[model samples]
Target: MYSPRFIHCLVSITASIVAGTFLQSTTINSEGSFTNARQSQAQKVQVLSVEFPQQQVPIVRFPRDVYPEIKFSEITQPQIQVQANKHLTIITIPTSLLFECGKHHIAEKAEKALNQVSQAINNRYSGSWLQILGHTDSKGSSKDNLQLSEQRAVAVQQWLSKQHHLNVSMVTTQGYGETQPIVSNTRFDCFERAIARQKNRRIEIVIQKLDHQV
Candidate 1:
């Protein structure tokens, strides 16, 4: 039979071994967690240290040349196409937009466009001659259409002169009546024919800028 003292000593030794194993396991777990945390922090630092290149995109613009100054040429916007050829700048305005359909009177909304063009011309191009030519669709009699076209052109000329402070002598007016057909109006569809007719009715402003000789 084992002595009581001997059994007590064996039990104490087993308890010590269990405690030591538990402490060793806890220390290993703590060190593993600390290493993982350090690795995570280092990865963040590495990511932040990397550099990226920045790029700048260029903006390009293409506009028909009217005047040398960009501010002055802005009046020749997309709606009013400006074409330059041999000392002349041709600015076109849709007569349908300027005037009501089948009428000689100018539309109220046309004031905005006229104001822009007038200001540009007045401020930039001094002593330049402006010629306004009115065109019409094939609808009415030649005489009546000619008279109507002339009246429409005259109305625009007067508006530019009086409202925009342009010189009356600097502007001249002409009418083409139904003689100049920009687009053919012989479409079977009503909508298509109307579209073609609208194209025919246009107001062309020709600006002649003479050379400056010192």
Candidate 2:
């Protein structure tokens, strides 16, 4: 029933309203996308800022004054004796006093006894050499055990060097491993005999008097 001119005017108004709504929606969508992009960039920057380099822990060495005491009853089964020669003073160190199972480094508890022994030697002899010997029970392979023994000896030597400020040349390390057995190798006696054989796994301090020829 409306005239042509009126209908044309109504259509124009409706089209303008729709175009305005669409423009508004497009503006809001663009703003939202920009905000999301900024947030993502911020998150990435924050992650990068928090990244840092990893640090390595240094090895710890104990002083010789803290060596633990070993009871005479512990080593009394066969009475392992330490021999002292003019150039060498062999000090028997029990496994019970020196190390725990599968550990090559010297414990902090054994430092005191080692210090005492070193002091005694220093008092009696001058310009002496110390050889740390590492021995193992005859249970594992010779090559593997020998390597472990050598590591143990080197660990003791490092401890002594750090504690006494001794020259590296004055100290030597050796690992005999299971090659030298002080007791018979048997299944029943293996553990007990290994404990007893701790005497052989000791540090021998060789005192070579400067006046004496090598």
- The most accurate candidate by lDDT is 1
lDDT for each residue of candidate 2 in 48-156, tens digit (9 for 90 to 100): 1232444422211111232222223223423233443222335555554556766787887776666765565455544655556677766567788778788888877
List the candidate 1 regions with Cα displacement exceeding 4 Å: 1-73, 212-214
The C-alpha local distance difference test score for the whole of candidate 1 amounts to 0.65
Per-residue lDDT over 1-214 for candidate 1, one digit per residue giving the tens place of the 0 to 100 score? 2235423432342122211111111112122344576744443222223334444222111134423322345474556656554455567778866887778877898887888878777775677777787878888787887788899889889999889778878778878787666578675488989888877777877666656510
Worst 10 residues of 1 by lDDT: 18-27
Q: What Cα-based lDDT does every candidate model obtain? A: 0.65, 0.52
Taking all chains together, the TM-score of candidate 1 against the true structure is: 0.61
**In model 2, which runs have C-alpha deviations exceeding 4 angstroms?**
1-81, 187-203, 209-214
